[model samples]
Target chain A: GAGVSQTPSNKVTEKGKYVELRCDPISGHTALYWYRQSLGQGPEFLIYFQGTGAADDSGLPNDRFFAVRPEGSVSTLKIQRTERGDSAVYLCASSPLPGTDTQYFGPGTRLTVL
Target chain B: QQQVKQSPQSLIVQKGGIPIINCAYENTAFDYFPWYQQFPGKGPALLIAIRPDVSEKKEGRFTISFNKSAKQFSLHIMDSQPGDSATYFCAASNYGQNFVFGPGTRLSVLP
Candidate 1:
């Protein structure tokens, strides 16, 4: 039984560059979520998907931030025109269907925009 | 505006002592409350959770006291150990989006 996993543990890029962070959720979990954590702060909601479709994307800061879970199992968060303000730890979480409100989290990818 | 507010940004407690971290939310619609524990470089792990119907829920040494009337909740760790030192976050459910989390509390339990 593997837990959620994220790729590119640490990524450093210049401003205006594009970066993609991937996440693999637990097997059989039908719901996935993305969050961002800034220094000394709580994780902020980004988006969440139920199955292959995003149920909510309101938390996404702007059009430059987008995510997809085309297969309902793996997801990728895409950021365009990265800004120093976007630098943070990107977190992925998943939960079982019928909604228990408990989400299992991955180690996260730290994005640094220089 | 932040939906949830948590306090004592950080705390230090001696082994065998109890440490309490409190959180308050402005949104009354929040239905579920859960606490997460995270060590450096590690992902957050669910510790304990409570629903609005109940005033208190205890599992092991961790306890969650919910005050629906006050729109607040508190996490209490009993007989804490040095191993318990970590950052703790309290979160409230936001319908389908998972949650709105409070600013985390960093706990350092000294042995």
Candidate 2:
């Protein structure tokens, strides 16, 4: 009965550098989602995966942001040419299935672009 | 334009008192509403959720009151404790779609 987990609790990188954030959803979960939370603001949707395939990715900010969940269990969020504006807490969540209302969330990774 | 709007950027209440937070959404397509609680340096946790079909739902001291006609909903925490101090976010989304979160309200419960 493990909850969702994320890697690199905190990350600091220089502008223009690349970064990758990983997420491990709860066992048996079929749906995954990614979000970004800036200081003093609510989380902003980034991408979502229904299985091995991404079901909804319209929330991705730009072409530089991408995610992959090849196995349908674990996911990784990749960012290219990181900018200061991208600094925020990257959150991952999972639900038992797509369309489920309640989602379990991970601690999240704080990315800082200096 | 923000799809979901929450009132009172912050609130302070004494222990055992009730604190109410309200949210309104512009999109009629939304059918699910959920409330999440988060502490500093941590991700949000689901506190409670409600569907448009029901007018109100209660779990323990947490209650969600929904108004389908006005497109508004509110969360009322009865007998709040100091440990309840944190940020609360109200979110709305259609089934199987991405969620839209409000700016959030910071609640402070004094012992």
Candidate 3:
């Protein structure tokens, strides 16, 4: 794809249900990131991946939240036992290199937990 | 602690006026500062960026002002237009670190 792409533009689920959000990064991008944005707030870092390894997962709120970049090109963010507080927009971004300053963002998936 | 802090949660300006949004950072290791603009439903797009070595950088109607000493930076929109009404975010990052974003400022350009 010419740009990053996210699946399920909008997802509405009930509390305690499990959900998965997928991201397809730009071709050949070696770095991928996941962020969450609440209403009226900026995106907050959730995790980062370098190749197939998670270089940094410190930002994940808890064990219920996990992300995997299986082949280093596409990634998936999984949430278990979702709560109402989990409602927010999930953003995916990618860069050519790990330390690159610029990251191209996808349209983002708006997740609503009722 | 919020690594990056932005002020004036919201700002309203006339179409032809200039709108300034300020941000301050606590980490001195940050080397790159970038501003992003986002409309209601779209993802943020990079507007302009500045490095610590340069005090200022301008691109078209958008300019970034950097203050290394005070650990502050600001975005100045020149000749603001109604189309420019959007939420602006200031972000900072050092090598190998995740980009940290400020709270963000919502700007409204009144025509």
Candidate 4:
């Protein structure tokens, strides 16, 4: 009965360092998504995975941003050579199907590049 | 260009009053309209959602009014309670695409 969960609730790292945010989707959830939320604005989609393969990754800002949902249960959003501008709340969500299904979100991991 | 535009970045309402948040989208491809509520330190939760096929949909004190021709939709909270005070976000997306969220409205209900 556990909902979606994310680890490393808050992470502060130096610029150019690498960081990985983890997400654990609900049981039997086949679709996972990643989003980034900037202050005073809305969440911007980063990537989404259907099972093991990423179905939609066009939202990823650049090549440095990547994600993997191997085993179709847990996902990790990895950022390489983090920039100060990459500081934001990274959110993860899951749904039963690909589209039209209500997504369940996790508490999110706040990544700060200090 | 922003796909979804929401108005009144913030709102204050009385406990028994109705707080309406409106949103407009430029992409006609959007078919599913969903509203999410978020607390200060938590993730967003699905509040209510609507499709373009229906003019209006109501669930309890929450109502969603859709205008297909106008490419707009609004969420109306009737007799809002203080517990409802939080950030409300309106999102638009197709059946199998990424959602575009609005800037969000910070609702403060005074009891």
Candidate 5:
């Protein structure tokens, strides 16, 4: 693709429902990342994947939040038992090699949990 | 703890004026500093970037002033315009690591 792509630009789900958001990164990019942004706040890092392995998942808030990159090209973020507090914009970004290279971000998925 | 801190949750600037956004970081290991601009319903895009070795870098109307000793950096927009109104984020990163972003500052340029 020309740029990173995210699925379900907007999602509305009731509390306790399970939701999955997908991200397709640029072709052959070695690194991919996920972030969450709340109203009036900066994007918070959620997790980062280097190739087929998750190099850093320290930013994952809790057990309820999980992400995976099986083939090193596409990734998925899963939220279990979503709560109202989980409502926020989920962003996905990709970089060539996860170093000094710039990251291209997707349009983001705005999840509204009520 | 937040690795980077930004100031002025919101800023209002008049047309033709210069708007400056400041950021400070505690991590000395960060060598790459970049600023991103984001519009409503859009993802953040790289506006400019600077390396630790350079004290300042300018690209047209945008300039980045870096103070390596103070662990601080700032973005200056010259001749601000209404179209420039958006949210700006400052971020820092070390080699092969995740970029840490500041809280972000909203800039509104009134025509």
Candidate 6:
């Protein structure tokens, strides 16, 4: 009955630092996704996981950005050498089957790179 | 480039009035069109959705009108309430792929 949840509702870090944002998808969800939302813009796709393996990582901006969902349940988005441009709300969503199914989103983690 | 485009970045409507938000996409491969509502400090929640085959779909006061030929879709909220004030985002996706979302529309339903 629980919805998706993310950790560290707000995180502030210095430039060049690394930060990890975690996501806990709803129970029984098989697909997970990560996105970034900048001010006055729509959420941009980051990465996707079908199970324990990432099905799509093309949305990831660069090699500094990486994500993992080892158990196919919980996921973590890791950012290396954070830049001010990376400052935005990191969103996580999950679906029951994937594809056309409705995606449930979490509150998101606002990461600020100062 | 933005694959999906939404019109009227902001809108204000009185209670019980209809507020329509329109969206258009350039990709013909897209099949799923859904609208999401979000409030401050909250993640987006699914409001209504429609497929390309269907011309329209309605759920409660929310309706989605899809035009397969024009590659356009619109969301109409009938008899809107003050509580309806929030940001609305229109998104499109192909089968089992990540969504391409529009910039979003901010709706203000006055009481």
- Taken over the whole model, the C-alpha lDDT of each candidate is 0.93, 0.94, 0.94, 0.91, 0.92, 0.92
lDDT of 5 by residue, A90-109 (tens): 99999987563588999999
Please give each candidate's TM-score: 0.97, 0.98, 0.97, 0.97, 0.96, 0.98
- The deviation in Å at residue A15 for candidate 5 is 1.0
> Which residue pairs in candidate 2 have backbone atoms (N, alpha carbon, C) closer than 3 angstroms, thus clashing?
none
Comparison by lDDT, 3 against 5, better one: 3
What's the residue-level lDDT of B83 in candidate 4? 95
Q: Model 5 over residues B1-111: C-alpha lDDT tens digits? A: 348999878999999999999999998878799899999999899999999999999998999999998889999999999999999999987774677899999999999
Regions of model 1 farther than 4 Å from truth: none
Give model 5's clash tally. 0
For all candidates, the clash counts are 0, 0, 0, 0, 0, 1
B62-99 per-residue lDDT for model 3 (tens digits): 99999999999999999999999999999998774588
Fnat, model by model in order, equals 0.65, 0.80, 0.67, 0.70, 0.63, 0.76
Best by lDDT: 2
**Candidate 2 local Cα displacement, residue B27, angstroms:** 1.0
Better of 3 and 6 by lDDT: 3
Q: Judging by DockQ against the true structure, name the best candidate.
A: 2
Predictions' DockQ, in order: 0.70, 0.82, 0.74, 0.73, 0.70, 0.76
Task: Provide the DockQ value for model 2.
Answer: 0.82
The 10-residue segment with the lowest total lDDT in model 6 chain A:
A94-103
Q: Model 2 over residues B1-111: C-alpha lDDT tens digits?
A: 437999789999999999999999988889899999999998999999999999999999999999999999999999999999999999998885688999999999999
Better model by DockQ: candidate 2 vs candidate 5: 2
Query: What is candidate 6's lDDT per residue for B1-111, written digit by digit as tens?
Result: 338999889999999999999999988888799999999999999999998999999999999999999889999999999999999999988775778889999999989
RMSD of 5: 1.2
Candidate 5 displacement at residue A44 in angstroms: 0.2
